[model samples]
Target: MTSDTTRTEPVASPTDRLRRLVARTEVVLWDFDGPICRLFSGHPAPGVAGGLVDWLETRGLRGLLTEAERHTADPQVVLRAVDRAGLGRGVAAELEERLTQEELRATATAMPTAWADPLIRTWTALGVRLAVASNNSPRVIGAYLAGRGLADCFGPHIYGRDAALHRLKPDPYHLHRALNALTAAPAAALLIGDSPVDHEAARRAGVTFLGYARNARKARLLADAGARDVIGSLEPLLRVVRERGPGSAPRPQQHLPHH
Candidate 1:
């Protein structure tokens, strides 16, 4: 007689999940600020946000932002608030330009995320397409990539904030744009990011997401946000990629017809 108890399959470890994700990803959409490098590492976001607020005050438009928004450390918050208020094009353009200038300055001291460079290069060598899907300025992303001599890894496929501040992450506009440009379907792509907004955006875009957290708090945040594959470092991913051997290539997918 057979035993009545049923057997259960063991859950895949984090590294195994990462390996499976990497193996199936034909295109990688990367968030600029956190996963690539700390864009405001030395520059500090609070100072930048304060400067934007100060600029508005100088124009006697401090009343445009609520108290919470005025003090928020994210410059994008300020810009979005101003835009939502239906501020004219001149004000919005100037504010975006100012933020861009600040980002360009921050590039000089931006700290690279360890293992990010090699992972990008390795993925490129394996014939996986790469593009930057970020909320930061494309100009700033370009500068950072160029400085690291990894600009060619992404080419001109960097998508970021522009005049349309409303299209930022959590909106999925940039991710959609990258998918369209790369001619890849959502099912064949993966996005690696740090924030809940990034996870939400990827979910909307129908792309798989991997969370890259440098600390426990971030890992916890991602896990709480429903990210199943969160890693404290990119090293594990790098190890998996290296283990795939130099001759391996991305899994085959039917190319979407270019419009």
Candidate 2:
């Protein structure tokens, strides 16, 4: 399904350009972490990472990692390091389960993005197909979506982290899985994500990418990675969809709030 998705619109405003991109998209592949909610807002990620490291120490595997790997705040990095150390299936599975539990706990306080809830609903009503492709576990994504009353919008199209950490993005395995499930051509899909890894995965999968930069730093990161389009806020996209047509759109308001 890999194909070029270059836009042909001439001299359009940024918003108009975005509309054109959206207009061509048939499948919306969303990343679980950023576009939808801040999953680690309440349950800090660093704390969870530390907890994982502690779990390793208790098992007498503390010497397996260098001081830096042991102290790294990214659990994925730690998990991968463990695998490289030949810790085997048992350790990997145990780490994954522990991380899943932590993620489940985090879901209770996951903060939805500013316009994500309503915008997701609006897209659903517009007959646009939606799916989540994330590095997080599918179970956690399902739980969070169900809790927010957004499960029905995506149904069973949630592709998440596999037991093999090596297969995660920017490997494009999960993205390919999502596209395959939807029977979608990559050119006809748009992935809205917040990281360069997401952009790289989308590019490798030949899917159009819409970068969601919640702050200037993220915007710069995406740009540096050669992202053609990145937005600081989803407000403009929400406005376009909300003004698309009768009944399919939400009512226009005096101001579209920023997140």
lDDT of every predicted structure (CA atoms): 0.91, 0.85
Best by lDDT: 1
In terms of TM-score, the best-performing candidate is 1
In each prediction, how many residue pairs overlap at the backbone (N, C-alpha, C within less than 3 A)?
0, 0
**Candidate 2, lDDT over the whole model:** 0.85
Per-residue alpha-carbon lDDT of candidate 2 for residues 148-209, written as tens digits (9 for 90 to 100): 99999999999987567776778888888878777777877899999999999999988999
Q: Please give, for residues 101-164, the per-residue lDDT of candidate 1 as tens digits.
A: 9999999999999999999998888788899999899999999999999999999999999877
Question: What local lDDT does model 1 show for residue 117?
Answer: 97
